[model samples]
Structure formats: C-alpha cells, structure tokens
Target chain A: MKSRFKTGIVAAVAAAGLLLSGCGPAATGAGGETLTFMFRGGADEKAAYTKAIGEFEKANDVKVNMIVTTPDDYSTKLKAAIAGKKVPDVFYVDPGSVQAYVKTGVVKNISEFVEGSDSIDLDNIWQYGVDSYRFDGKLMGQGDIYALPKDVGPFSFGYNKTMFDEAGIPLPSADTPYTFDEFVDVAKKLTKDTNADGKLDQWGTGLNVQWNLQPFVWSNGADWLNQDRSKVTVDTPEFAESLQWFADLQNVAKVTPSVGEAQTLDTYQRWMQGQIGFFPVGPWDVSTYEKLPFEWDLIPYPAGSTGKSATWTGTLGIAVSNSSKAPEKAVELAKFLSANETAQQSLVDAGVQIPNLIDMSDQWVKDSTTKPANKQEFLDIVKDYGRGLPANSTYSAEWYDELFKNIQPVLDGKKTAAQYLKEAQPKMQKYLDQANQAAGIG
Target chain B: MSTITRRSTLHRKEQRVALIFVALPVIGFAVFTIFPLLFSVYASFTEWNGISAPVFTGLANFQAMMVDPYFWQAMWNTLFLMIGIPIGLSLSLLLALALNRKMRGTTFFRTVYYVPVISSIAAVAILWQWAFNGDFGLINQALAMIGIDGPNWLANTATVKPAIIIMSVWKGMGYSMLLYLAALQSVPRHLYEAASLDGAGVLQQFRNVTLPMLRPVTFFLVVTSIIGGSQIFIEINIMTPGGGPEFASASIVWYIWQKAFNYLQMGYATSMSLVLGLIVFAVTAIQFRLNRRNQFSID
Candidate 1:
C-alpha cells in the first residue's frame, strides 16, 4: 500500500511539473510589443506624458507603460532595477548615472535606431545636450536627438527684493552680477538683527555648500576635472582661492546660515517663505516663489577674479534598457516624446518643463501669456553664461558624492576651503583618471 | 487486558499526531532561516554585485577591513550607543519598582511612556532633527532664553552622536521598563518580608532581596540590549546623512548599506557584514558569560 501511495504522488508531481512547463514565457508586454518609460516628474506631469503616449500609441499601434518617480529617488531605484536584471524598456537617464548604466551593459545602444529613423530631428537641441547623451562616439539615446529638457532654471542667484530695498542695497544688475568681493559686501549688508534682541534674527544668505558652490569654483577658473576629464583640477590656486572666498561667507563675514540652521530653515523653503536675502538656486524654485508675498529677481552667479561667467547646466535624458524585449518600439516612443513638436509644445504649455528643441521652443519666449515676469532675466542669463559640466560618465557618481560629502566640514568651519579642496583633489583625480582610462577618453 | 492494550495504542497514535504537527515548523525553520544563513556565509566569500556573475575572492573583503576607517567609526558609534543600554535599563528598573506598588495613574504613566516606542522611528527622527537644529530650533531657542550658546547638536561632530543616544534612550526605555515590570511582578513578596524581618530597610531590602531575585531578568536585558544596540542603523541613518559633518556619526550597519547599495560593492559589504556579525556574536557571548559569573549567588 505504501508503494502504491508513493507512485500516486510521483504521478501527481509529474503532472504539475508538466503543467508549469507548458504555461509559456513571461509577459511579453503590452499586447506582445510593450515599451516602458521611466520619468521622475510627479502626477501632474503625467498629463503631458499621457498626451504624448496617446499620439505614439495611435501612430505605432503599440502599448506604452509609464514608470514615474521624483528626481532624487529615480537614480537609486533605477540602479536597483538594473542590478536586479529587471530593467524597463525606456527610462530617464541622468548625465551622472548614464555612463555607469551604459558600462553595466544594461542599456540598449540606440545608435543604430537613430541611423534608421529619418523622421526624428536632432538639429534643434543645444550641442552640449546632444554630446552629453553620447557614449563611445556612438549615440546611446533615441529619436535622432536628445531627451527634451523640460523646464530649466539655469544657475542664478535668487534674492528677496524687499530685503535689498530695506537694506538700501541696490539689486545686482543683469548685465553683471556683483563680483565675488562685492557679493560678500552685499551679504553682510543683508545680514541684520531685525528684533534687536542681541541675537542674529535674520541671515544674509542661505549657504548651500554643494552644487550651488560650484559656479564660484568655476568662476575662479577651477574645474572639477581637467580638460581631458582625466584628473581633478580643483587643487589649483584658483579653486583654493574660491574656497577661501566661500569660507569668508561664514567665518569672517558671518553672512551665511550655519549648516544646522540651513537644515531647519531649509534654504529653499525659507527663500520661498521670504526669510532669506539671497539664495543661489535653479529654476526648480520658480513655481514655489510665484506665490510668495515678496518680489524676487534672478541674477547670474557672480564672476570671480578671472572674470569668467560659469554656470553649470543640469541635463536629464532618456535611454533604452538592453534587457527590453522591444528596443525598436522603445526608440519609437522616445522619439515621439522628445522630437514631436506637438508633444513638446503641449508639455511646455502645461509648465512641465523647458522643452529642449531650440527652434520649436520659440514658444518658451513667444508665449507671453504663460511666461513668468522674471522669465526674460532667466533666459538672458542662461543664453549668455550657460555651460554644462563635462559629462565624465563613470566618475560623476563618485565625484559628486565626494563634492557633496566634503562640503559639510567646509560649511561647518572645521576645514578651510583650501584644505577641503586639497584633501579632495587626490580622491577626485583618482576616480576621474579611472573613468577616463575606462572610456579611453585620453 | 485487550481493552487496556487498545487504550495504550490510542494514546500512542495521539503522540504520533502531535509529533507530526511539530515537524512542520522544524522543516520551515530549516528551509527559511538555516538555509539562508548558510547561503549567506558562502556568498560572503564571493564577489557578487546583486546582478552580476559572482567570482570567488576568498578573504579579500575581510583583508580590506584593516584600513576601512568607516568600519572603526561605526564600531565606536556602536560602543557609544552601548552607553545608553545601562542608562536606559537602570532608569526602566527604577520606574518599574516605583510603579509595581499600587499607585494612582500608574497605568496612565506606563501607557504614556510606551507611546514613543509605538510611534514610527521616522517621525521621531524628524522631530529630533528639528529640535536639534542649530538655529530656530526649540532647544536652541530655550538655550538662548537662558543666555547659553547652544552648539549645532546634529551638525557638530562633537554633539551629533550624543544627540542620537539621548533620543534613542527616550524612545527605547519604556519597553525595557515594561519588561522589568513583568520581572518585578514575578518576584516573591516573602523574600522582601524575610529581609525586612532581618532589620533591612527599603534600600537594603532592594539591594539584598529584590536585586538577587531580578538577576535573571537583568542578565536577559543586558544580553538583548548589547545585540540590538550593536546593530543600530535607523536613527543614525535618518537623522544624519551618512554620519554627517564628515562621517563623525557613521555606524557600522550604515556603512554596510552604503557599500552594498550606493557603491555597488556587495561582496565587500557582505564580508564586512560577516565580520560585524562575528564581532556581535563574540561580544554577546562575553556579555552572557560575564552576567552569569556575576549573577547573585545567595545562600
């Protein structure tokens, strides 16, 4: 009887195994030809994507699935997805992580897709944006062009008009922002104790010691990486001088908020709440400031002794995953979303982003009805002074990590700017050299 | 005789049924906990980034430990937190003793104290981060009122770890207090009576009688606190980003996370984690041995 029972169980197991084996492959996706799109904008941004996808789906007769997250969460999640071998068909790739992702063999090389498609437009994008999307002299992005740079607020100093007026300090002119020395003077003037309780009740400037501090370093003719993007250039005298100037904002001038105070007041939120005098920020804050009680103006970051106007641009693009079952369909979706004029215009109108197609983006200038009052100032500064950090693909992840990591001590008055840069130079150079060697950039 | 034998057979069948029911849980443990632990041990010796093909590099990860400053910093932070266990445990014991007697609103106090433990760590971290904020924070504002210059508690290298330790004690003590309460309730009242008869006052009775009786409970608390405190992660992670102000507050577990997830150095992270696990085991073992040796031995 036991032998019979064992035989019955064996038969049942065999039948179940056969059934599982016959169930067929994983979901081939969206009616057997699926394309996945990853983006970092919130739900309101979905309307723009939905309209774009609507047109693409109709044109290609394929289905598109959208994955969305905030910019901050996007990189970590994307890395996990790629590492897990569960990559979506298409995703937004930040310039910082693009090289790392491409090197991992997880993203599809879309150079061939661009060659094959004549309907996509490439001429409308800025040269730097286009170059940023390339790896190994071959385009790794799709649609014969770069991902549309939705709304951009170029690097500029945002200041409270009320504070400046109250202090009797004239606003920095659009033609030329205050020089490093004058900027320090202005910060001190803005720093005042309103309550007169023998305590610092108001701060002159909000000290963002990371990306915001970069333009100052660049203005002093210091670059994070050398011309060949092979070594760190920050240990130079120019960068050291810039760091000293930055340290003075706190230690000598007492104009900038302490790091702990910055966290509590949240420099950005405080600027929006009209508590700060001047803040260096990007276009991300425009929407927040639109509702503020005080008038605000955007001015270019001040030039240093070198007289160079250095403004670093942040570019986010879209790429296809190598594991995607439908590469061609993914490219089609990328092209339709980025190159199509109707889609770009609709997105721009929705305040989704500053569209990247230069010729087609005339609307950003022409749409007088939608443009903010300060739009002209922002546009003028970005047009004249804008430049992007060389997208040294593999090193940006580590380089920026070091940049942001080391700023804490500098801001806290523990390390001088010169000391921080001197210590960080070797670390930055080591990684940049590694990346350059890996990419054969030299 | 036949009926008696039948009854014995029935009893044997019941025992078999009980054994079969118990066997399922043992199989589950072997499959889940035991198997994964063994697999992790093997993986720790390999260079596997979550997605890539794993290569065996026997002890390179372990060798890397000698110069990893982050590892030492984490160890120091763990030791820093160990300071809290005794502080928390003693306070909890005191509270438990005071509340053990029938008193008005004792239940209310216990409930209010446990509220923090039930609250989310993230919520607590947010509140503490603000309170410790260098400027415009409640703590700083209060200090200003007293003409004291408050340091940036979360941002300053010297004060960050202490701030976290104090917050942890506040959040952690109630549970330990409840455990002490349970242990206190189980102690016999006759021992205290006998001590009092021998001319012992309240303090003397507590030291001689109540303490000896609470030895097992104290030993249990110390062992568990050592294990838990050594693996502390959430408070430091949420309150301070990668141990802020140049990693002055980095804990060991946070480094493991940064290496594994952010740096994509999983093999290195796992090896370091193994070393940490061994360290925790040795420390816990030593603690248990010490507690056993020091356990009150009353005649």
Candidate 2:
C-alpha cells in the first residue's frame, strides 16, 4: 500500500510538470530554424498569408509558425506572450506601441536591413506607411525604421448607390466631396418612411461619433493635438462646429437612427440590410461588403469649410522581436510580406487590402471592373490627404479616449459641443501629460 | 523495546504515506498561487511595463490610484453589481422551495432553470445584449406589450448597470437554486412536525425551522457570489467593450485588465488589484465573523 501511494504521487507530480512545460513556447522544429509570426485577422487574411509566405519559405528555406488571432483578442494575447518572455519572431505593431517597445528593447532596429535590401525600394512603398513605424530614442515618425507596413487601412466613406438611384439623386463625384450642407440636404431627402407605416424605416446616414467625427474635425482645420504632440487641441471652435454638426445629424436632423433604434440593430447591420445610406468602409471590409444586399461605392467624405476631405489611415507594421534567434530569416519574411510584388498583388486580389505598393496600387486603380468602380478614392486618401489616427503618435491612447468618455450628452443634444469640449480638454490634457511622463518623453 | 520500535516504524510509514498523498497539490499551490501572489505584491510597488525589468515606484502608483476617478467609479460600479447578490439569493431560495414541493414535472422545471448556468458566459452575454435591445428586444417587446416604452438599456447610462445586473442574476440564479434545493432536501421532516405540534403557524414554522435549516447554504451562496461578482470581467467585456456608455458599467477587475493589458500600465494595475484583493479579503473575513455566532451546528 505504501509503495502504491508513492507511485501515485510520483505520477501526479510528473503529470503536473508536463502540463506546466507544455505551456512554454513550442519546441524548435527538428533540426531546422523556425520563425514564429503573429498577426491579427480572420480566415481570409490567414489564407492570404499562408499562400504568400509559402513562396518566401521556399526561397529562404525556413519554417514559419503563424499565430493568428482576431483583432479584439490580438492585443491581450500578444501582451500575455510578452509577459511570458516568449515574444514571436515577427508580430504586428502600430505607431502607438513603437515608443514603448523600442525603449524596452522589445522591437529591433531594422533601418540597416531596409537600406541594404536591393528588392525593397523605399520610394515604391507609401511614405506614410513607412514613416508610421519609424522611431528614434525620443520621437516617432523620424529616425530608424523598426518595422514594415503590412497594410495601410484607409477609413473611406461609402454611400449606398442603390439608395441614391432609387431616390432620383445624382451620384456623388469621385474626385470632389460634398459640403456639410449638401450632405445634410441629401441625407434629409433620403430619410423617409418607405413602408407608409407610422415609423420611419429608412434613413440617410448612421455614423458612430467616435469614428465619423474625425474627418469632419480635420477638414475644418482642427485637430486633437498640436504639431509637436505636446498639447490637446480639441477645444477649438472648428472642432466644436464639426462636433455639433455630427450630433445634429441625429438629434436635430433626425436623419440617423435614434439611440433606441440603434440598440435593436447597429448602424452597420442597418446599412447591410439597406435601411441606411452612408457608412465608413475600410479595405479589410471589402470582401464582406461585396456580399451586402445593396450596391455601395466609395466616395470622399463630406467636407467642411476647407473644401477638402480628411480621414484617418490605419496601418499594422510587421515588427521583428529584439530577442529573435533568427532575425535575418524573420526580416526576410517581413520584407516578402510587405514589398514582394506578387504578395502585394495577391493580397489585393484577395480583397483583404489595397496594394501597399504605390506602383501596384496605380495598376490596381486602372481596373474598373471591381465593385467599388471608383477604387482611386482609396489611393487618393492614402497618397494625398489621409492622416494617421490622432492617437497613433501618442505613447498611450487614454488621452484620446478621454475625449469620448462623456461624449454621449453632446451626441444626445443634452449638451452643446462647445460646452462639452471646454469640459473635455483639461481631462484629455491630464491623461496626455501622464502618458508623456510615463514614456519619459517630456 | 522491540514492540515500541515496531509501532514507531509503522507510525512513521503511515505519516510518510499521508504526506506523499498531499505533496502534489501542496507543490502546485506554492508554485502557481503563492508565487504569483507574492510577485504581484512586489509588483504593486514597482513601475513595470511588463516587457522590461521593474523599477520601484514606491507609493506613486498608490497615490495615483487614489486620485483616479475612473478607478473609484469602477469600484462603485462593482459594489452596485453586488446588490444583485441578495436579490438573486432570495429569488433562488423561493425557487428552491417551489421546486422542493411534490409537484409534477419538477425535474423538467429544474433542467429548464439550470440551462443558463450550463451555457457559455460569452454566448449568454451576447444573447442578452441582443435581448435587452430597446426597440425590438425580447425584454423591451414584452415591456411594450404592457403599455410601456423601454429606454435603450446598454446605450443609456442610467440603465446600463441595471441591465447588466438583471442579466447576471438571470444567468446565476440557477446554480444557487440547485444548491438551495439540495439544502432544502436535507432538512429533517421531524423538525417541521415538532414546530407544527407546538401550535406554530405555517409562517412561524418556516421561521423557526426552515430558515435555521437554510442558514449554512445561504452563507455559502453569499460568500461565493460576492467573490464571483467582484471579479466580473467577461460579461462587461462582451456586452460593453468600452465599459458601456459613460463608463457606467466598468467593474474593478475589468478596469485592472484594461490598464494592465490594453494600456500597458502593469504597475498601476497591479496596485489596484492588490487593493481590490484586500477589500475582498476584509469583506469575506467580516462575513465569517458575523456568521460565527449564528452558525447552525447539526451536532
């Protein structure tokens, strides 16, 4: 009995040890270099990466372990990996993380690789995309390039073409944007009770204040931060006017879904069901949007007093881990993913992203057979007027988030935009100050 | 001398065998629980970005947490959520009593009630998110049938917390009800008979016999519910990604998670969690003390 008990305990301990060891990073594949690459996307993206990386793997003679996650869970999973000290060889990053990651030696400096590569012509890639991943000891956007842009996502505006046609409204110009007043007039005309019921079933526009407010604010010559990124500039009159205009689309104009109505089904679902007219479209959304019941096409967002459209372009960078054992092979994979003509073309064809290359995107624009017919609108924004998300340059986004925390009252029309901005500036500034202090960048 | 030696040898063998049985769990406790607990305690006093070596920050994170309005708001929100505990327990006990009766289809009713407890939390939260929709939701549509228009539950700041509370209670009552049912089944028939023989009315009999019988179960439910309720994260994350409108429904654990992972402020988050741990510990201790005098000893 004593011997049996001892064996049982021994087996239990062995089992426990095996379980703990299993949680560690996967063992290196038998006698060959293995590079782990982590990224965020759904099946279509994973499929694209799988095909594209196959070519790179054959050329480089290395095994790549791909860790995939959805956008929502990606950050938490990556943070867990970082905490465990099992950072992937190549991973997705953004401008916001560059400062902290670089300081902690989490990401490696890759300017030498970029300069030395004969295949990757810096001028061919979007300058904005490339600059987003650049960081020196103190500032972002200038200094050594630490990562390569996977894809630059432009937050472009799309209108339901069928809705416009049914309403006997002329199609919006691809090159020119509608003024705020023109956009409102069009929206009012589209907002109607289609079924002849007591309730209004169809509407002109449905915009989330957090996302849609930025284009309006930027076009009106206002911004969330100053040139030096040292101060919060959200309290200006232009910003308030843009905000008030956005709020009035729901409260005063009633062209958008009411808060109560939105709770039943979000604006995205409404747009998908042909109940709403205008919505924001990202490159990543093309495949899904293609299946929508209503026909839609890209348009420049409605302009403010400046008569110019503005929107935020989001990009994910492929960064090399500072602790990577196979840095050269990992960097080769990153380059192939970013700059390889076939890879970029295939990714674009997959409808997951616009071509990251300037020349390739130009070629892509010439093909007018795609659903969006006006694909140039994506490039126009990316090349001409698109700016980084206001929070992208900051060390932390708490400051950016503080601007929206109490913004409901304004959207509900309980508070004026000017009053809201006045109350919001100091709160945002305080968080920004804290973020800067944390980064030790003051 | 030989007999004494043999007995000592047997005793040592028995002790060794018992200790070998206990060894695995003890090691696991020390390695997984005790080690992380001590590390977090130390981390509470340091500035750790989680990627680099930790630097001691002394009381800075503590002082900063004290001034963090959002942290206090989360704490209050967490406390507000605990109000559902007693409400849930009371309703569950009533359910347990009803199910304890000799009724037809009691088993079916029990299974039906326990469905939510078995369902995944993420799936349930998503379903509830849709069900609480203000216009065409299951809840609002039912409310509308009674001549009332419902406000948007999650979109509105006033109703978000109450909406979450209602969801959580609906999700949690089944498990508590099952526990209470078992407790009720164990209550001795002779005790009720004795109370009735003493001329005790139904209410009096319930008060004198049933209530006392349920004391232990009630205590267990309250303590477990509070611990579970205080660490509410999954529901808030699913239903209200940005912590609901105006940060109205952000729980303390959700806030800690956001700070640590999303914002990469591990040091500050650790400090907040340590304080939260202390608060939960003190509350549990106080409950234990309060229950000591009133604890029903079957012996």
Candidate 3:
C-alpha cells in the first residue's frame, strides 16, 4: 500500500513538472516574445522614450516592458535587480560600471551585434561615445563593446545672457574660452545686489565643488589620478592651485552665494531663476531649461593657464543581460535605442538630449534659434575637449568620492587646498588599491 | 485491551497535529533569520561583491575596518545620535505625566502627539530638510527674529548630527510618550496614596511610586530605541544623501548599506553589519540582565 502511495506522488510530481515545462516554448513562440528594457530619466525623457519605443516594438514584432526610474535611484535599483538575478533584458549601463559588469559576466559582449548591424552606422556615431563602453579586461574605452551609448552628455557651460546684458557686461566670446583670471573679473561684476538691498540677490556662479571643480582642475593640467589611471595624483601643485581658486570664488571673491544662502536655494535652482550668471549645462537639461525666464547660451568653459577647456561628458549605454533568454530580441532593442534614426529624431525633438547620431547632431547644431543659441558648443565638446568622468575608468567610485568627502573645510576656507590634498592622497590611494583588487589589477 | 490501544493511538495523532501547526514558524525562522545570519558569518570572512563566488579572505576586511577612519567616524556618529534617546525618554516621561492628569482635551493632545509616530518617516525627513535650510528656512527665520543667527543646520558638520537628532526625537517622542502614558495610568493609585499619607510630595511620590511602576516599559523602550537608532538610514539618506558633510551623520546601517550597494564591497559591509548586530545583541543582553537584577525593586 505504501509503495502504491509513493508511486502516485511521483506520477503527480512528473505531471506538474511537465505542465510547467510545457509553457516555456509557447511564450517564446513568434509574436509572444517579450523583452524588458530599463533606463533612468526625468519626465521629458520618459515621454520621449514612451513615444519612440512603440516603433521598435512594432518593427520587431515583440512586446517590450519599460522600467523607468529617476536618475538618482537608477544605480541602486539596477544593482538590486542584478543581485536578485532578475536583471532586466536590456538596461542602462554606465562607463563606470563597465568593468564590474564585464568582470562578473553580467553584461553580454554585444560587439558583433553592434558592429555587424546594417542599420547602425558606427562611422556616423561619436567615437568617444562608442569607445567609452569598450573594455579590454585591463582598461576601459578600448576593447570588446559591452553596450551602446543611449545619449552622450556634453557638460557644456552656459551663461545667463539676460544677466550679462542687464549688467552691461561684455558677452563672452563663443569660440574663445575665457582665461580663469578674466572669468573671475567678469564674475565679480556679475555678483551684485540688484535691488540695492543689503542682502545680495544675484550671484556670478554657483558650482558644486564635486561636479564643477573638475573642469577647472583638468583645464589647469591637474587630475584626480595619473595618466595610466593607476595611482592618485591629486597632491600636485596645479590641483591645489585650481582647488584654491575655486574656493576663493565664494570665500574671497564672494561672487557665488554664501554657504548659508546656497543651503536654502542651491545653485541649480538659482540658475533657473536667472540669479546665477554662469552654470554648467548638460544636453539632458535642455527640456527643463527651455522654460527658464532668462535667456542663456553655451560657450566653452573657462580655461586655466593651460589654455585648454575641460569638463566631463556623461553617457549611459543600453546593455543586454547575459542571462536573458531572448538575447537576439534584447540586442535589437539596445540597437534601436542607440542608433535607430526615427527613434533618435523623436527623442531629440522631445528636447531631452542631443541626437546620439553625429550626422543628426550636426544638423541640430545648425539650428541657432534655440534657448542655447551657441548649440555648436555642445558638439564641439562632444567631438573635442570633454573628457570621460574620472570615475569612469575606475572599478568603483569610492576613490573619486574620497577626494570630495572632506572638501567642505577647504571650500569654507578653514584649510588651504594644498594641506587638504596632501593629507587626502593616501586615503584615496587606499580605496584605489581596493578598487584595483576588485578589478583583478595591481 | 483493544480500547486502550485505540485511545493511545488517538493521543499520538493529536500530538502529530500539534507538531504540524508549530512547524510553519520554525521553518520561517530557519529560512529567514538563521540562514542569512549563518551566511553572513561565513561571508564576513570572505571577499564577496554580492556577485561571483565568495573567496575566503580571512580577517582582512575586519583589519581594514579597524584602520578605516570613515568606518570609525560612522560608528562615532551612530553612537552620538543615541544621545537623543535619553533626552527623548526624559521629555516623553514629562509629557506622559502631564497628559495623565484630568486635563481638558487630553485625548486630542494624545492623538496629536501620536500623529508623527504614525506619519511616514520619509515624508517627515523631507519636510524637516526644508525646515532646517539655512538662509530662508523656518528655523533660521525664527532664530533671526530673536536677534540670533542660525548656521546651515544640515550643511555644517557640528549642526548636522544635532539637527538629525532633534528631528528623530520629535518623530519618536510621541510613541514613547504613549507607552509611558499607558504605564503611568496602570500604576496603582494606592501606592501613590500611601506615599502621600507618609508626607511625600508630588515629586517624592513620583520617584517612589510612578518611577518604579514605569521601569519595565522604560527598559523595553531603551533597548528597542538603541536597536532602532543603530539602524537609522532613511533620515540620513534623505536629509544628507552625501552622508552629511564628511559623513558626520552616517549611521552604521547607512554606512553598511553604502558599502554593500553603492561601493559594492559586500563582504566588508557584511562584516560591519555583523559587528553592529553583535553590539546590539550585547547591549540588549546587558539590559535584560540588569532588568532581572533590579526586578526586586519593582516588585
């Protein structure tokens, strides 16, 4: 009797397993193929994607599930999904994460798909955007492609044209990058009390030290790391000099908002309200910046003694998950987001970013009637002086963060930049060493 | 003889049924708590990035943690924030005593105080972030009216932890007040009457009668508050996303979460978390032992 009961249980289990296995092929059959695409963006970005994704769905004859999150939550959410082994079929992968993803085999090597696709014109896309996602096992920006660029963010500099005109200050030349000395002089005049009240309502510049200081540092021939990206080199005199100059913008020149005033409104909001004279503008800010009360135009960021302009370009790559069952469809979805002309046109029209296609952006630059009248500056940065973010080449951003962790004292002018960086290098190097260990590099 | 055999078989069947009913939580405990805890112990000694196989690295993570200034700073910040627990407890006790009297609109006051206790923590954190802003914030504006200048509450290192502690106390005081209120009312009136008859004043009576009666609740609150305080992440994450000016406001849990998720140093994070868990465990154990030793006084 016991033997019969066991046999009955075994038969039932067999039937259940068969029933579950039976549904797998049916779902993958013809029109039933579904792929998940995850990316982070704001409202306009979401609208642009929603409008563009349908064409891809119709063309591929498959369903696509879209997961959109705010930029702040994207990395954390993506990491959570990866850890749970439920990675989206295709998702936004940044240059910074390329090494970690490839090392762990989380991302598919989609070089062949990207290179061989007749629809994608690699020659027409920005080389820097494509190279940023490449990893040769030892270094980033060169090797097998793991993802395709969604949008290349050129961190262009924008000045309030209204503020410049109202103050009767000479407009900055679009082609010539202002020397740091000349830039500081203009900023001093731009910083003022427009209402003649004791409290200053207007400011020249309000740049976060973490984000905006990089441009000055790089233009000064100083960097967070050495050329080979192996060691921390922020203790150099050039870095300290640039760092001190940036601090002096607020503490000495009083051109930017005081720390207390900034805590209330922050620099970004100040720019939106036409209070700030100069600010960094990314391609992603176009849609939001359109409705600002003041006129603004792009120009090269101020140059240091090096006589060169420098700032980072940010990009997100759409990567296929290695674990995806529908790899071909997933790869196609990535390709569509990156290079499909119709999709790129729609997204550009939505005013979220410049077109990923270089040929398309050239035409975009020709349109001089926009809020940023000097749209050509955006292309120039993408094609030239804009460097990949320092963190992009590292295995993790902990070392980059270490540079900014105790920066407040310097910013407040309580400590000199030289002393601060001198003390900070070892701490940064420790984290860099940890990062190398993680990347399986010395 | 046959009847006896059948009765014994019925008892065995009932025992089996009872065992089946108890197995669910046992299985849950094993899966959820015991398994992760055991895995964490193993992972703490290894180099795991939450992906790929964990390689045993023996005490490297712990050794690094000892010299890591950020780790120590985070620990100090977490411990510093618990200073509010005692301050909050005293404030709640005073409030409970006030509300215990036959006051007008006691129920309304009770409900109002408990509102924050039930309000969403994230929303509260965001609301407080705006209020603590420096130039034009509610706090500085009020301070300015009194001929005083307020520093940037969330931006300055010295003020950031206090600002967070103050917000935490405001959010948590209501819950503790409610518990103390319940404990206050449950104290026997006869004890207070006896104390009063023995020439004890209100303060004397409170110390002799009310304090003793509230000991158990206080013990419970202190243990739980320390545990909760140790794990504070939401307020810190929202109010000061960059870990609050050199990480002066980072708690152990927040640091652990950053290491595990943001930095992808899961093994190091796990080791820090294990240290945190053991600390909490030791603290709770000590509290329980003390409570047991002092049980006679309450009795």
**Each prediction's DockQ against the real complex:** 0.24, 0.54, 0.41
- Ranking of all candidate structures by their DockQ, best first: 2, 3, 1
- Alpha-carbon shift of residue A379 in model 1 (angstroms): 4.6
| Window of ten residues with lowest summed lDDT in model 2 chain A | A259-268
Which digits, one per residue and each the tens of the lDDT, describe model 3 over residues A268-308? 88889889999999887888898898788898999997999
What tens digits encode model 2's per-residue C-alpha lDDT throughout B111-227? 999999999999999999989887668998898899889888888889999999999999999999999999999999988888888899989988888889989989999999999
Tens digits of per-residue lDDT, candidate 2, A94-201, equal 888888888888999999998768867889899989999987766788999999999999999999999999999999888889999999999999999998988888
lDDT of 1 by residue, B192-220 (tens): 88888899998898888788788888888
For each candidate in turn, the TM-score is 0.85, 0.95, 0.94
Q: Residue-pair clashes per candidate, as listed? A: 5, 0, 0
* Per-prediction TM-score, chain B alone: 0.89, 0.94, 0.97
| Model 3, runs deviating above 4 Å | A1-31, B8-17, B297-299
C-alpha local distance difference test of each model: 0.71, 0.89, 0.88
Report the lDDT of model 1 for residue A383: 58
Point out the higher-scoring one by TM-score: 1 or 2.
Answer: 2
Where does candidate 2 stray beyond 4 Å? A1-26, A263-265, B1-23, B296-299
Structure candidate 1, residue pairs in collision: A150-A353, A150-A354, A151-A353, A151-A354, A153-A283
Positional deviation of B13 in candidate 3, in angstroms?
A: 4.3
